[model samples]
Target: MILEAVMLQVKEGMESKYEEAFREASKIISSMNGYISHELQRCMEVKGKYLLLVQWETLEDHTVGFRNSNEYQEWKKQLHHFYDPFPIVEHFSRVML
Candidate 1:
């Protein structure tokens, strides 16, 4: 599986709205092809900071499949506005060792 990780820093005072929007946006991501699972975690020490972890069957599932779909536009509409400077997304794979 491929793991997608993102560090999100929301705009000040928009945390609650962002979370609510994320809840709605979750459906979009969850319905994508090859999506395994995902979780969003808030940082205890930093307000408006969140960690997003998503598991996919393959990296292309997220990078190409999802990102290029119509649903991605909806996802972006719901949650993209909340980011302060935009989040950086990275992917990883499990090591056999």
Candidate 2:
């Protein structure tokens, strides 16, 4: 499986709204091809920092199949406003784990 990790640094007092927006945006990603699963984890030490993890069957499925679709635009609109300085998303494959 391929894992897409997105790190979000939400501004203070905007956590709730960010989370709500993500909740809606996730549905869009989930409906796309190669989507395996999705999970969001919050940082215990950093109040507004969060990790958004998405599992996919292949890299092309996410980078080409899903992102190329019209759905990505809607997802971006719904969730982009929450970022203070935008998140950097990276992908990885399970080499050992």
Candidate 3:
């Protein structure tokens, strides 16, 4: 399994808008090939920070497959502007239980 972690900081007073954008884009993401699941987590201490965790069958599913698909373009159009600057994405593979 591959884990894609995206940490984002939204503009003040735009949390609901960002959330709405995510909801709109989630349909495309969830339908992408090799997609497993996705979750959005809100930080308790931070006011505008969110964690987007996506699970895929392999790294290529996210790095290549999703990037090459038309769905990605739509997803990008819907969700790209929600961040202040941009979100940083990282990937990981489980090494232990």
Candidate 4:
């Protein structure tokens, strides 16, 4: 599985609204192909910081399948504006221990 990670810094005073929009945008992402699961974690020490983790069956499932779809536009419309500076999304795979 591929893990997608993003560090989101929401605009000041927009945390609540951002969370609400995130909840709505979740549906759009969840319905996409090859999506395994996702979680949004708020930072306890930072008011506007959040960590978003998403598991996908493949990198293209997100980089292409989702990002290329119309649903992505909806996702962007809902949550993109809340970001202070745009977040960088990175993908990872499990490392053998």
Candidate 5:
């Protein structure tokens, strides 16, 4: 499985709104192909910081299948504007050590 991680910095005074939008946006992501699971976490130290973790069957499932789909546009519409500088997404696999 591939793990997609994103560090999100929400715009000031928009944390609650972001969370509500994310709850709706989650439906869009969870319905995509190769989607396994996802979670959104809030940071204790930072007021506007959040961590988004998603599990996919493969990298393309996210980078291509999801990102390139029409649903992605909806996803962006639902949650993208809440971001300040925009989030950077990265993928990972198990170390298997």
Candidate 6:
């Protein structure tokens, strides 16, 4: 499995609206191929900060299958405007110790 992490900085006073928009956008992501699950966490120290974590079966499932799909456009339309400087997304895999 792969984990996709994003640190989101929402525009001031748009937290509630962003959450609502994310709720709708969540459906779009959940329906995509190779999607495992996802979670959105609000930051305790920062007022307009959030952490978005998503699980996928493979890297291509997100970087290719999802990002390249039409659903992503809708996802962007719904939640992109709420961001201030935009978020950087990173993917990770488990490491054996």
- State the lDDT of candidate 6 residue by residue for 18-79, as single tens digits: 99999989999999999999999999999999999999999999999999999999999999
Off by over 4 Å in 1: none
Residue pairs clashing in model 5 are: none
Q: Going through the candidates in order, what is the number of backbone clashes in each?
A: 0, 0, 0, 0, 0, 0
- lDDT per residue, candidate 5, 1-97, as tens digits? 9999999999999999999999989999999999999999999999999999999999999999999999999999999999988889999999995
* Full-model lDDT for every candidate: 0.96, 0.90, 0.93, 0.96, 0.96, 0.96
**Decoy 5 TM-score against native:** 0.97
lDDT tens per residue, model 1, 50-80: 9999999999999999999999999999999
CA deviation > 4 Å runs, candidate 5: none
Report the C-alpha displacement of residue 53, candidate 4, in angstroms.
Answer: 0.3
Worst 10 residues of 3 by lDDT: 79-88
Per-model TM-score on C-alpha atoms: 0.97, 0.93, 0.95, 0.97, 0.97, 0.97
Q: Is candidate 2 or candidate 4 better by TM-score?
A: 4
Collision count of model 1: 0
User: Which is the better candidate, 2 or 3, if ranked by TM-score?
Assistant: 3
Query: Global lDDT for candidate 1?
Result: 0.96
lDDT of 2 by residue, 48-84 (tens): 9999899999999999998888999898888788788
Candidate 2, superposed: residue stretches over 4 Å from native: none
For candidate 4, the per-residue lDDT at 54 reads 100
Candidate 4, 1-97: lDDT as tens digits: 9999999999999999999999989999999999999999999999999999999999999999999999999999999999988999999999985
Angstrom error of the Cα, residue 13, model 6: value is 0.2
Q: After superposition, how far is residue 73 of candidate 4 from its true place, in Å?
A: 0.4
Candidate 4, RMSD to the unseen true structure = 0.9
Give per-residue CA lDDT, model 3, range 16-73, as digits (tens).
Answer: 9989889889999999999999999999999999999999999999999999999999
